[model samples]
Target: MNRITITILVLSAAATACGTSRSATGGAREGSGTVTGIITLADEVSPKTGDFCSGLNVRVTPTGAPEDVLGNGTVRTSRSRCSYQIANLPSGGESLAFSVKLPAAWQCGNGATPTVTPEPQTLQLRDYQTETRDFRVSCTAPSAETSTATP
Candidate 1:
């Protein structure tokens, strides 16, 4: 092998090594997609204290594989809204499920347990696609009657 040919070969190998990194789960980083959305409280419900926006948790996993979490992010207060984004997901028209959980203190406006809309949403994600799925949480002020009731 001549010196020029050997140099070219080495450069090619180096480039390949640096191309298309891998994610934490050993998945190819290329062709990854992102999921982003906002979490909102129902219009008629509100909490007196604590930052509800910052207490929301979002999780992404491959559909039917709850144990394998692709990515997760906490919602942040963005301009009077709760927003979150889970990026770097392995996308190839694969089915992925997303779910959100609100803080325990929040209760449904109907005086029941709190619940979010579109729970455990599953959808096909394509490479380089950015999907948006918003969620609305129903919550109201803590029931004073229950809290004050004596045993």
Candidate 2:
């Protein structure tokens, strides 16, 4: 085989290996699942009642226990607007904690991400294949209450 052809083959092989590299963190795979629904307060007060909490954030953490923040991140919706709909999440056992957060208001010029850490909620999966986790935010403020509650 010509030297040019041999070099091309080696480069191609290297590129393929790099594309599918996996390290400590399980890189990537093909599995389908979903998490959708609106983020509403657990209290009887309707979200449409016009309140600061109406625009609250909904975040998901992959942890059965609320204390365990396996994977912490906020969901994306409209600009600066938060919603509860983490679509097509990775497939795994029920290991997520849902919470209603009041993230920092960027418009106010405060760079800090202000968050209202509600009681951690254990999510239940209908089916690992395709699940819908519709949860409610704990209306009872954590500060006012002493004992912690789980959802």
Candidate 3:
């Protein structure tokens, strides 16, 4: 092959190694960025799941993405801690929708309940970066339980 042709082939192969490149085998470095956040309630309630936050689930979807992209970023409460993280997200400026799920055991009590209305939040994320946002729910202890608290 001519020198020009060989040089072009080499450049093409090199460019394909970048993060944004997609290989013929459907291999690409996707989701090099991360998105993280916490879930909290106005009132403290007993964690139904061991040390972890109970009656909670988190779902994150790419903003303006197609419906077929379901289940891209999804997590359920199980371990200790109320925070969650979605890693390996594609780089560049992207948006996400954060939402939660609560079980029946999470009492509404006398205080406000977790904010699930006003629409779930949409967060913008970039590659090789982490976005931290918290979601507050209006949850309160039972009236009797709260009243009986030690002084």
Candidate 4:
């Protein structure tokens, strides 16, 4: 065989070997997941002004790894229901925490402070899995009243 042909064959074999080695040593793979859900307000407390959903900020991060944010999304308000989705998250046997930031202007139906159910939730995600987690914001009226009269 000619020297040029021999050299080409040797380089090709080395390239193939390197590729196989990288894969065997935990190289990048397709194992991303997604998290999506809706944010809803109580029927009685639906905001009457601007879009309340727009004020919400959804975030997902590796559990115990707050500095490493995996994904983030904002709520898209449609009438009464608001939806959000965070996609393309690495999901190889990892736990993720989901949380939201409430708008400061939110107020309850009965003139009370509003609260979010399941303020922060964590779940285990697998490859190519799409997890659904819903959140609700609601509040109840204060049962006790304070008297301002003084003698």
| Superior by lDDT: candidate 3 or candidate 4 | 4
Candidate 4 residues lying further than 4 Å off, grouped into runs, are 1-31, 48-50, 72-74, 143-151
Model 3's alpha-carbon lDDT is 0.57
The candidate maximizing lDDT is 4
Q: What range of 10 consecutive residues in model 3 has the weakest lDDT sum? A: 66-75
Candidate 1: worst-modelled 10 consecutive residues by lDDT: 22-31
How many clashes show up per model? Answer: 0, 2, 8, 0
Q: Regarding TM-score, does 1 or 3 come out ahead?
A: 1
Model 4's lDDT to the true fold?
0.73
Q: Give lDDT tens digits, candidate 3, residues 1-151.
A: 6999999998988888675655322334355666677666544544445544544566555666433232235344633347666666556556656566765566554554545433567765565677776666665343453466687
Stretches of candidate 1 exceeding 4 Å from the true structure? 1-22, 28-31, 43-50, 72-74, 108-110, 139-151
For model 1 the local lDDT of residue 65 reads 84
- For each candidate in turn, the TM-score is 0.66, 0.40, 0.52, 0.67
Report lDDT (Cα) of residue 136, candidate 4: 84
Cα deviation of 125, candidate 4, in Å: 1.2
Q: Write the per-residue lDDT of candidate 4 for residues 59-120, one digit (tens) a residue.
A: 87767877666743446877676788887666787777777887776777688777778677
Quick one: RMSD of model 1? 6.0
Prediction 3 TM-score vs. true:
0.52
Residue range 13-113, candidate 2, lDDT tens digits: 99999998653224442124456654443333232333344445555555644443332233544322335555444456555566665533212212222
lDDT of 1: 0.71
